[model samples]
Target: MRWEDIKRYQVIEALLLWEGKLNARQLMDYFETSRPTAQKYISEYKQLNPTGFEFVSQQRAHIANDDFTPQFIDLEFSSYHALFNTQGEHAVTSLVETLPQVHRNISPQLVRPILQAIRYQLRLDIGYISLSSPEFEDRIIQPHSLVFDGTRYHVRAFCEKNQDYRDFVLSRFSGEFAFEGEATFDEAHDTLWQTDVTLVVCPDHRLTELQKKVIAHDYQMTEQKLELKTRAALLKYLLQHLRLDIYQAAAEQQQIVIDPECRKLLAPYIN
Candidate 1:
């Protein structure tokens, strides 16, 4: 099928699944097309499965049938939200603006084995490189879960070489990983993954009253302070991602500080 026709079919399924009905006016307004064009699209879709919808003259719309089955799209909110972000067919402009990002280069080759290992409790023997070591080394690891720290994906796994749980960046795997065997370590044994740590943050004490207020407003803080909770194993990554790893920069540059007690508690794990 043509790309345009697939998009039209997906929108039709989205409306039917979410709103329980669809009308030509919804299509006309959404696609900015003529009445006959909207009707033609609906007619074309109905021809694929005549039992998918039933017309209601009172409502002037086609209500989805009790046995309606979508062929073009699944009922996932993320998929619907992605379609919604386009703001309808042929929309090119957006009301929102976001910072530019250079997408990471994580390949499906690395992701697939990690997912399979996590699912079946298997071990992986792979070559990995680390910034600290600067060379590829072969090791066995049992992946338990996957994590995305707002920037990139990390596999939370038990490293047989290190004898502990560690977060391995997906992009850092240097070569193909093969399933070694069943995993001997289990997720329940990873204490850090099971624990929660609270990070209390406050506007830098050195900032002026107005500056502190602005910082508080930016973070939606209550009384110039905010407390964030994260998994103990992820506390370091969370701090690094938020640029709160070190509270030693100039007050205006840093903007925030971790509570001294919280910093002390996290000291052993932050490195």
Candidate 2:
């Protein structure tokens, strides 16, 4: 076997030892390897000791020894599961449908380690591709949590380079990921946490199904008006892409309404 393959083998072994024993679907995310590759690895590992491996088909989980069943931490699966594991299904299928197309790019392999890191607060050495740059940069980032906006998966990590917390879009990254060490941040995205947006929704638009859903889930609505309480940066992104028709005294106007705070922040875009 090649050195990289041997490392992959070792990594799988270590992960199984730590996780007790994971199912084929679980292994695909844990190792970022294909189902066939995971199966081959399992078969090879089982071959070494014929009596060591056991399968519980009903539970859809595996056990290393005949007497032991693996225990799992309760967790929620996101879009990454659908992208990587073909057999797996998401619980929130309706919510998934309303989301933007960017979320479909989430890779299952990218989700698990980051989740594990946040759970344990581990620092990771990753070859990350930044959104603004064409080159891949190697950096050690302290991962906190995964944020799922309607359209994409973001890894919120304390970037050593920026000396601040930043979000990395998972699908754009390509390379080996390594757990370097442990680190902590006083707050993740301090500026973002402090920022808020106020969305003044006109009464006529309040009855739309999409408006009702967005209001219910994302904002607080009061008497035909909604105020979106969210980060300013996020609101700016929404404003830039928003498609809506405006009516001023029966004259139809086509424009997207941005929060006042967002409009000032996005003044450069104003013409």
Candidate 3:
């Protein structure tokens, strides 16, 4: 099936799972398609998951089956919020554009089980690889949350072998996953993830006064600085996203850096 067709079909699956019902008219309004075309979307989805939904004559709609299982789309809520997931949301089809993204082929099979582990506080035995270990290394983790570090999907989990919480990239996982009963660590035990930190950003002082003013305005700064808060563990990702690395570019070109006072306080976390 074409990518566009799959996107349309996933929309049906999302509504059926989340809203508990699917009807041709509702699909018509959502996709701006005719009755027959909307029916075609439902038909195509039904073909993929035959027993996913059933018609409710009283409501004149296809009600989601109690055992409704998704054959397409990652049902994890984070998939909906990710900037690059684009599971069901179609992006601008015209002139508006964005930089090409790295395609992270994260399988729903990997995601669903991780989400289940997080929800139930269970441990998972997984085969994963990292830059240091090019081969898949068997490891056990107790995942607490799903994180999007601007580009890739990561599961923030407690690594049993490492004896610390770490972000494991979803695409790096391989082989089959096995649930390992209960997890000793959960979100509450992740001190860094539980704590919050503030970032104070300001335009480079070396820039001309006018340039500094423009930069401040661009970042919606007040009092010549932008103050923002985020999870302590996510500080590095936020810095990378804002391009605030002081050594990356010339002061004038970089435009912004964390305020010296805040930088001193946040140095340990960023490192």
Candidate 4:
């Protein structure tokens, strides 16, 4: 199937799972397709997964089966939010009216060269602004991969200026960038990016028993602890996101604490 068809089918599947029932008209409006095309997709999807949905003649809609299981769409919080936050008839009012978002202007001009450099194994000369430096400076970097840490986009690259592998935030990149011949380093050589680190998180020991229970349940912790593995380079960001970096903070403030062993492993990365 075409990529577009697959995406539309995934949307249909998500709608059925999230809203319980969906009709051809809704699909037509969402995909901006003809009624017949929308109906055809629904029919094709139903035929592909016979037991997933049932046709309701009275409602003229396809309702999810009792034992319906999602295949194309991941039933994750982010996926659900993306599916419902679209600008269309199927858009849903978010439960949280005001959500925090990182404000950064990322230009396609800056991103395109970085992506091309990574794809074609090339180097790039870029102007970047960092927290330590107020002015943008020229830097030669061997681009590797792009990472999204929820709030912003980061390009993991080998910085010639720093003589090390580092993350350059996309938004902080200034001016135009150009390909500067073949790259000296790839993703394989990025030690931090290549290495995996496990983070064991538990409710702050300072919290009361009841508070600990609530924190455990909130994090869906098993046995009062949650273990998550991520790239070593991303450990600091993940810790900061979960408020685990400030171990000395009060239980009500930090809520969770990292295991001492895990903390020791993450020491180099943690600020």
On TM-score, the candidate that comes out on top is: 4
lDDT by residue for model 1 over 1-271, one digit each (tens)? 9999999999888878777899888788778889999999999999987899989999999999888889999977555556666673433213234456767667788688888999999999988888897888887999999998988889999999989998898888865777888999978999999988899899888999999999999998998889999988998888887788766658988998887888899887777
lDDT of each: 0.85, 0.56, 0.82, 0.83
lDDT digits (tens) for residues 129-148 of candidate 3: 99999999889999999989
Q: In model 3, which range of ten residues has the least summed lDDT?
A: 87-96
Q: Distance from true position, residue 256, model 3, in Å? A: 0.6
Residue pairs with backbone overlap in model 4: none
Q: Which runs of model 1 end up more than 4 angstroms from their true locations?
A: 1-92
Q: How close is every model to the real structure, measured as TM-score?
A: 0.68, 0.45, 0.67, 0.85
Task: Rank the models by lDDT, top first.
Answer: 1, 4, 3, 2
RMSD in order of candidates: 8.2, 14.3, 11.9, 2.8
C-alpha RMSD in Å of predicted model 1 compared with the true structure: 8.2
Per candidate, the number of residue pairs that clash is 0, 0, 0, 0
Top-scoring candidate (lDDT)? 1
Residue 232 of model 3 has an lDDT of 94
Clashing pairs in 1: none
